[model samples]
Every structure is written in C-alpha cells, then in structure tokens.
Target: MKIENIRPGDIEAESFRIIGELLGDRKLDPRYEHIIKRCIHTSADFDYADSLYFSEGAEERIARGIREGAVIVTDTKMAQAGINKTRIGKYGGQVLCYIGDSDVAEEAKSRGLTRSYVSMEKASRLGRPVIFAIGNAPTALMAICDLAEAGQLDPVAVIGVPVGFVNVEASKERLIRSGIPCIVARGRKGGSNIAACIVNAIQYSL
Candidate 1:
C-alpha cells in the first residue's frame, strides 16, 4: 500500500474486500453478506457525504466490552481511554480492564479489577481472538498472532484497522498470523474510526 496515498476511508474498503474473500468458501448466510454490505456502504456513505468520515463513540463501545471482561487489546491511549469511558458511561464503574501499558496494567491489578497487562502472549492465552486496532504496536499485534498460532489464544476473529498512515499492513499481518478469519480495512486509509466501525459491524452481525 502507498503510505502517501493511504487514507482512513480506503482502509475501510480493503477490510470489506478481505472479509469477502475470507468468506468465499464458507456457508455464509445472506444475512452475513448483508451485514458486510451495509457496513461497507455505511462507511462509504459517510465518506461520500464529506461530513463525519468516521464512526463516533467507538472507544466507548470497546471499553464497554472490556468492562465486561472481554479481554480487550489496543495500541493507543485514545482508544484505551475511549473504551474506558464507554464502560464507565454505560456500566457506571470500572471495567475488568487491561491495557498495553505496564503501568496501566499494574494500576488495574492494584485496584483488583481483573486487570492485566495486554500483550500478544497474554492475549493469546485468553482463549479468545481479539479485535486489534492499527497503531504503533506492530510487535504486540504480531505477538498476539504468534500466540494464536501456538494455540495459546484461540481468537474468534481478527481485524486490521490501522489508524493514520503508519504501518497499515501491521494489522493485516496480525490477521494473517492469527489465522482467524477477520474483517479489516485496507491500505493506509485505516484509522481508529474505521477500526471501530468494523467492530460495530461485527457486533451487529453477531
């Protein structure tokens, strides 16, 4: 992918294509295809409108899951904070949270909130594939895939929604490494907004 030409919206399209390819041989219900199409169109709709090119409140939704003890993993403080706020706003308390930071992990543990540091190794051991956002944490994402390959983490799915232009391929690489079929945004166009949209689609699909 051309880093210079990459945009967040482009990644959203790529993710849809990848998911379609992954489901090629599966007994995918029409509903599943509808969900993907709706999501893709929704994203494109926003992009075409020239207003609100990203999904709002994604961090909050992720945080809600984390608060519910969903073994979440993310690579950005903004995402982490957004997730936390979502949990707090919806659940009115701290969620069983873990973060990529050592200090945050320790803090969560100190509070006895079922906290642990997020690492690929740890995420893999959690017995579930996690939705990974694109960020600067390629190493961590790769580690998560390694663990999945080693059977440490049996992730249900993977996603490549890298925000901004840096390392868009990292999320895709993680999805490939995890070997858990997933939906991802393509190229350097992915960002936090696109990643969150994909997650929303997954949640709605389920």
Candidate 2:
C-alpha cells in the first residue's frame, strides 16, 4: 500500500491559497465565496462564480436544513452518487434518488410524465424538509417550482443546475422566482458534478 505522511487536509488548504491568489482584486461576500470557489475547483471553470444565483440567505437556509437532517433528493442517479454523502451524513442528511426505480418508472409511465417529475412528486411526500440537489433533467427543476407555487412540494432549498440548451436557462430562472431558498446556475453551463459540488460546499462549511 502507498502511504503518505501528509494528511488529505493539506491539499484543500494549498488549493485555497492558490485560488485566492488567482482570484486577485475580485471579491464576493466572504460568506458566499467558498461555494463559488468550490464549484470552480470541482470543474476547473471560472465561470461558475458569475453563473451561480442565490436567494437572500440561501446559504444559511441550506446549512440549517442540512443540520436539521433534511432529506437530500437528486433528479438523477449520477447526481446522487456525486454528492459527498459522507459529509452529508455528518449532519444527519440522507441522499435519495427515485429515478430509474421501479415505482418511479411505473408512475411516470402511468401519468405519461417524465421520471424527473415523478421524482419531484416523491420528494414532496418525504414529509421532511427537502434539499433538492438537481443536476440533470430541467423538467425536475420546472416541476419542483410549479409544485412549490401550487402548494404541493415545500422544499427547504433547491440546487437546480441542469446543463443544455433545452429549458436549462428557463428552469433556473423559474427557481429564482419560485419563492424558495435556491442556489441555481443560470445559462447553459451545468451538470451533475457541478450540482454536487454546490451541495458539498454547504456541507463543508457547516
């Protein structure tokens, strides 16, 4: 086995120093900066800092939900797997994915709805405060917003960052106006990894 004397903690510390240097005179509210840095770090894309949209106090709301043991639901299995589940577990959060599940498939087929919408419907029924970490399927993001507005699903926070030209921009825009605490990536640049990165940043902070 290859064993190193240095602990894993050193890497993040060093990376932070480098990131800080590269960031230069540009500044964000310190409280929200780490989330941007983490996203960029995860994808090596500097555009995330400008792309991320946050509601007032969204970070605090999300952290509180995490500490309160919110059920974290993802629209895709890739997103579910990409989250730092170990870190989420530290705060009593559990990740959930209903996509590709037999029940979800059956319901989607029955209703002629996308599995993403079915997953959001299921998330609503968890009865616990939900932190939706969606990275694919703009349909899920749009559905969650509609459900929230219609007095159906009441998610504590939504991380909506699906990538593509189709409905990607529109869904995120809807989340901004959905009246829920949201951290969204606007425009056509997002994916499962970026979505998971945002979740991990909040978990790491608290």
Candidate 3:
C-alpha cells in the first residue's frame, strides 16, 4: 500500500494546467474565453470550449449589469443554489428561482404551462434588470423568447442552456436567431450547473 498527500490549492492548480494542456491549440473567441474555461472546468469537457456561444458584447453587458445590481432569475432552484450569491449580493443583486413557489406552480397549472415557463413570466415583471438563466426546461426558454420578441419583457441578458432531447436544441436555436444579448450552449448538452458556472465566471471576474 502507498499513501500520498497534496495541498488542495496545489491539486487545483495542477488540474487547471492539465485542462489547459488538454485544450491544446484550440482557441476560443477570447472575449468570453474565461466563461467557457470555467464551464469546461466544471464539466471536464473540452468540447465546451467550442460549444459555448456568446452574443456580441454579451459578456460585457451582463458583467456590467451584475455590477449595477441586476437580478438573476434561474429556471431551477439548483441553478440558484449553484451560483455565487455572495458575490452578486455585493452589488445589491440576488438570485431567484420560482420553481417551488406556490404562486408559480398555480400559475403554471392555470396556464397549462410548465413551472419553468411561469417562472419566466413572473420574472418579466421585475422592474429591475433581469438576467434569465435557464438551464432546464426548454419551455422556459421559449417563454422568455416569446416575451422578448413581443416587447412584453426586456431582460438584461439571457443564459440559455437547457438540457434534453426535446425542444432543447430548438429553444437554443431560437435564442441564437434572436437579437437579444445571450450566452448559450448549442445542442442538448447543458444543465443548471453549467448555467450557474457561466454566471459565476462573470461574477468572479468582476
């Protein structure tokens, strides 16, 4: 038998070095490289380096909004829990998830919509700038996009990364075609944790 020990910081530092090596000569857009890097770090998937897409100036706008007290509205509680709340709070912003709220549930039932869709509808009412982070439920992404297109809601930015076989790719494709500011993961390979990582990456940078 053999035993070895290393400092946690040292381990993480080495891990990042390995991640960089795994990346090789691959190049990201540079503007949103840090955000993608954090996603890859969280998932240990180098493919994210290319899969993640950012609308022009999306990172800068979202970062500035966060600094200026913009609110974060996530589709699921998992995403709310995963984000860096303390950092956002420093700028008087908070993370919200209405999935478990009674009103949201009731509204979803009454409207024949998913809870995530109703959550976005509720979030659209917030007078403050809202950054919708949807890492689950393609219906939610569709709802937000509909609102934005109708000029019913004006979100500061959208982070769309819903994961599933159904409607996931379609919802993301809709966002890409949209003129709104967004950070998205193309295809059907994203989740709440990935959404949180993108938000935290921006928050930590600031």
Candidate 4:
C-alpha cells in the first residue's frame, strides 16, 4: 500500500479536485456547486450530486435570510451542535434544537405526538425569520408543512434531509409541494452531519 503524503491544509482541496475530476462533463449549477461538493466531501458519496433538490431561488432566499439574522431550528441536538455557531453568530443568527426541551417533550407525550413535531410547533412561535434544518425525523417535516399550510409559520427556508424509511420520502414530497423554499435530499440517505454540512456550505459561500 502506498500512502500519498499530502499536507493537512491541502487535503480538502485535493479531495475536491478529485471529486471534480470524477464528475467530469456533469454540469452543476454554479450557485449550488459548493453545497453539492461539501455534501460529497462529508459522506464520500457522489449520490448527493444527483439526490439533492433545490427549490427555485431557494439559495438566494436562504442567503438573504441568514444575512438578516434568521434563526435556525433543527430537529435533533446533533444537528444543532454540528453547525458552525461562530459563523452564524457573526450574522446575528443562532441555532436552536427544541427536541430536547422539557416542554416540547412533555407536550409531545401529552398529545401522543413525536418530540420533533412539538419542537417544530414551538419554533413557529418565535416571531422571527426561521430556517429549519431537519436531519433525523420525518415528523418534523410534516409539522413544518402543516404549520405553513395553516398560515401559522412562514419559514425563510427549509433543509429537509432526514434519513429513515418510515415516511421519509413522503415527508420530503410534502415539503416539495408546500410552495416553500427548501433544499431536500430525495431519499433515505441523509443525517445530522449532512444537514450541518449543508448549512456550513451556505455560510462558506457567503
């Protein structure tokens, strides 16, 4: 086995170069190139280049919202912890995960609903521009759709990439049809890490 000696700082650049080579002749929109590349870098899976879906003008909307200090809500604490808080804070934005909140848990238990659902409901009342980053629960996506339908919440953008078999595809489909700005992974192949990477990619592009 031969190990190529590459500098630590240049490893990521080299990896991206290889990825670009592997994707030769495949044209990706210049606007979303960073996001697609970042996802592939995180998972070592080129499938993201094909699976990721972006709503029309979603990137511009999300970038503007972030610049204006939108609050980011995630379905899982892992996603919340993975985001780059320092960069978000520079834009006066903050990341929140309500799945672990005691009130959210209690409400979900009392209503026979998942904690993710209750968390979305709770986030809706924040009275500020919000960006949802859901990576672990389809129920969370459903709740957001419901809230939007009811005219109770208007999220700036949604990142729907929950990884699961149970209603995962259905939830993403619902989000796509909701007429909301969104970025989605169109199958059961996402995670908190991927969700965070997406956010980081957007931030890095800014």
Best by lDDT: 4
Compose the digit string of candidate 2's lDDT tens values, residues 1-206: 99547678798777777787887887866888989998888887878878888899888988999888888999988888888888678778899999988898999999999999988898898889898999988999988988888898888889988999888898889889877889988899989998888888888888
lDDT of 4 by residue, 85-117 (tens): 887899999999988899998999999999999
Local distance difference test, each candidate: 0.46, 0.87, 0.89, 0.93
How much does each candidate deviate from the true structure in C-alpha RMSD?
11.8, 3.2, 1.6, 1.0
- Give the TM-scores of the predictions, in the order they appear: 0.47, 0.92, 0.95, 0.97
Ranking by TM-score: 4, 3, 2, 1
**Tens digits of per-residue lDDT for model 3, 97-171:** 889999999988998999888888888888889998889989989999899888988888999999999999999
In candidate 1, what are the lDDT values of residues 31-58, reduced to their tens digit?
Answer: 3344345444545432211211222333
How many clashes (backbone atoms < 3 Å, residues ≥3 apart in a chain or on different chains) does model 4 have? 0
Q: How many residue pairs clash in each candidate?
A: 15, 0, 0, 0
Better of 1 and 2 by TM-score: 2
lDDT of 1 at 133: 48
Worst 10 residues of 2 by lDDT: 3-12
**lDDT of model 1, residue 159:** 44
Error of 1 at 29 (Å): 11
In candidate 3 the C-alpha lDDT for residue 96 amounts to 90
